[model samples]
Target: MNNILNIVKHIEKSIIFILIVFLVAILVVSVVDFGLYFSRLLFYSSLEGWYEPEFLMPLFSSFLIVLIGIELLETIKAYLKDDSIHVELVILVAIIALARKIIVLDYSTMKPEKLYGLAGLILSLSVAYFLIKSAGISMKLRKKSSVDQK
Candidate 1:
C-alpha cells in the first residue's frame, strides 16, 4: 500500500510538471498563431471582393482568447487539486460543444433522431443542475459529520 501511494505521488508530480510545460508551449503557440493570422488578415484586407476581415478577424481572435482562458482555468483547477469542481462548468462546456455542432452541421440533412439527441442534452443539463444543488447539500452534511466527530 505504501509503495502504491509513493508511486501515485510520483506520477502526480510528474503530471503537474508536464502540464506546466505544456501550458507554456500552448501559450507560445497561441501567440505565434495569432500573429500569423493577424498578419494575413491585414495582407488580405486590400484585395477586391475579399470578405471584410475587420469584424471577422477580431471575432475569431476574441473567441481564441476565450478558449485560452478556459484552458488556463482548467489547468489551475487541476493544479489546485480541487476535486469538487463547479458542476455548472461541466454543463456549460457540454452546452457550448453541442451548440457548436448544431450550428455547424447541415440541419437540413440531419436525421429526426438527432433532434431528440439535442433534447437529451438539454435534459442532461437539467440533471446537472440537480447535482449542483445536491453537492451543496452533501457539503453541508459533510461539515456536520466532521463537527460531530470532533
Candidate 2:
C-alpha cells in the first residue's frame, strides 16, 4: 500500500511537470508566430508598389490584427499568469467581433429595431475600450513581472 501511494505521488508530479513544459513550449512558439505575422503585415505594406494584392487589404489586415492580438494576449496570459486574461481578451475580441459584424452587416435582414441594437452593441464596445484603459487590465496585467507573482 505504501509503495502504491509513493508511485501515485511521483506520477502526479511528473504529469504536472510535463504539462507545464508543454504549456511553456506552446507559449514560446505562439509568441514567435505572433511576431512573424506582424512582420508579414508590415512587409506586405512595404511591397505594395511591387505587386497588387488580390484581397481587400483593410479587411484582411484588420482580421489579421485581431487574430494576432488575441494570440499575443493569450500567450502572455499563459507565460505570465493573471486573473484578467479573459477580460483583456474580451475587450479586443469585442472590437473584432463588431468590425466583422459591420463588414458583413445584412441590411435587408436587420429590422429598424435590430439596427438600433447593433448600433448599441457598437456603442457598448466603444465603452468597453474606455473601461479597459481605465481598468489598467491589459499588457500591464499580462506582463507583470514573474517576480511579483508571489
Candidate 3:
C-alpha cells in the first residue's frame, strides 16, 4: 500500500512538472506577443492611439492574461513546495481573470442578466478572499500571543 501511494505521488509530481514547463513556455510566448503589440501601438499618433478602445482593450486583456499566468505559476510552485493549495492565491487569480473579462467586454451589447451574474461572482469572490485573509491573520496573531504568554 505504501509503495502504491509513493508511485501515485511520483506520478503526480511528474505531471505537475510537465504542466509547469508548458506554462512557462506559454508565458514566454505571451510576453513576447504583448511586447510586439505594444511596440506597434506606440507608433500610432500619440493620445489618439492610446484612447482607441479597439486597441486598448486587447492590450489590457493581454496584460491581465500574463498577470494571471504569473499568479497561477506562483500557486503551482506553492502547491509543489507545501503539498497544499492556497485558496487566497486561487481567489486572486480568479479576480484577475474577471477583471480581464470586464476589460474586454462590450458592455453595450451585454445582457442585464449576464452583467448581474458577473457582479454576483465578483462580490462572492471578494467576500471569500476577505474572510480567508482575516482568518489567516487572526490565526497568526493567536499563535504569537500564545507563544508570548508562555
Cα lDDT listed for each candidate: 0.60, 0.60, 0.83
**lDDT at 54 for candidate 1?**
43
The residue pairs that clash in candidate 2, if any, are none
Q: Order candidates by TM-score, high to low.
A: 3, 1, 2
Candidate 3 TM-score over all chains jointly: 0.86
At residue 88, give the lDDT of candidate 3. Answer: 85
Quote the positional error of residue 3 for candidate 1 in Å.
4.3
Clashes, model 1: 0
What's the TM-score of every candidate structure?
0.54, 0.42, 0.86
Q: Model 2 segments beyond 4 Å from truth?
A: 1-80, 83-86, 135-150
Candidate 3 residue pairs in clash (backbone atoms < 3 Å): none
lDDT of 3 by residue, 33-87 (tens): 9998888788653656577798689789889989999999998887777666777
Top-scoring candidate (lDDT)? 3
